[model samples]
Target: MKKTIGRKEKPYMLPYFQMEEDSFVITTWHDGQGFNLYTSNERYKTLERLISRLPKGTIIEND
Candidate 1:
């Protein structure tokens, strides 16, 4: 799936990730919560893999 960086409904928690082209960006949410804790290269890789496995258009209700 294409990695589009943007808000996830919250503001405090920013979910940052890179797209297939390695373009990095940070996304939070409209509610303002749930930011990404992974900063290291390894952690980001792990997150990328995990998120990639999720089904397309999977909505994360929690912020």
Candidate 2:
């Protein structure tokens, strides 16, 4: 199967891997059961820090 980005309902798989910058992978569901993405907004800071360390064009997979 082809790797993909974005929610399954709106997948941008091939195009997502073609871009040079400013591309995003999105998901409609939260990681933890019963805890939405917004339930812990504070994690964004740490997450941002970690992501910033990655080289440009890096693709992160939650799984």
Candidate 3:
């Protein structure tokens, strides 16, 4: 995995890890109270499972 920086636009981007094996860009940003994760649709299930371990007000939806 290669760590890289994302675009500096709206909502403020965060550092992302690039998976060359699957060509995926995974990143997470905070919105003061919670976190917003950005990734490919294929990882939705995996992401959901991971977020399940976190507190209810952690991951922000519709971000």
Candidate 4:
């Protein structure tokens, strides 16, 4: 008989964000997940800058 090992899946987190500009939006997900969604802007320079400054293990609080 052979034994098999199972892999665990990552948990999903809720997303939250604030509109910073007409072309870009900043969003943070649960469990310290963060990313930016570009509505129309393709440059994405500002979004990249902001995400880089975020601290590790940082989560967004919901009201």
Candidate 5:
């Protein structure tokens, strides 16, 4: 996959992720101040480990 980011007037486009199977994918983007992660998988133990590592204020969303 690919993405467009940065200022709307001068956005930057780049290749983002790749997957061969049906498993979920994880990709990150910069939000100016820091980084943000978007995930399509919800494997419990993986999430547990991820949550354990991030700072407390990180926002997590599920579908």
Candidate 6:
């Protein structure tokens, strides 16, 4: 009897951002005194840049 090898499934990547809305405001601070507004596309790019700058093994909390 020959044994068949099964293909391994790809590991699932945990979602760091919930980008469902049409527009996204990247960040705001000091009661809207200071803010950085970005479009949906820009938001994604900014997030990617921020993530890349972080040190390895950095765990992001999504609460």
Q: In terms of lDDT, which candidate is strongest?
A: 6
**Residue range with the least summed lDDT across 10 consecutive positions in model 2:** 33-42
Q: Show the colliding residue pairs in model 5.
A: none
46, model 4: CA deviation in Å? 13
Flag clash pairs in model 3: none
Report the C-alpha lDDT of model 2 over 1-63, residue by residue, as the tens digit.
434465345434442234334433334556433221222233343656656766999776654
Candidate 6, which ten residues in sequence have the lowest lDDT sum? Answer: 1-10
Task: Residues 1-63, candidate 3: write the lDDT tens digits.
Answer: 334466444454546665454354433445555454544545444756656667878744545
Cα lDDT computed for each candidate against the true fold: 0.52, 0.45, 0.52, 0.53, 0.53, 0.57
Model 6 RMSD vs true structure:
13.7
- Candidate 2 backbone clash number: 0
lDDT for each residue of candidate 6 in 1-63, tens digit (9 for 90 to 100): 333356555555542555666565556767955445455554346656656666999775533
User: What are the per-residue Cα lDDT tens digits for candidate 5 across 1-63?
Assistant: 334375345545664666444344444445554334444445423667677777999886644
Per-candidate clashes come to 15, 0, 0, 0, 0, 0
Ranking of models by lDDT: 6, 5, 4, 3, 1, 2
Candidate numbers sorted by TM-score from highest down:
5, 4, 6, 2, 1, 3
lDDT of 1 by residue, 5-63 (tens): 77345435445555454344445646765444434444356755656666999655533
State the lDDT at 11 in candidate 6.
Answer: 54
**Residue 8, candidate 6: alpha-carbon lDDT:** 52
lDDT of 2: 0.45
lDDT of candidate 4? Answer: 0.53
Instruction: Report how far off residue 15 is in candidate 4 (Å).
Output: 10
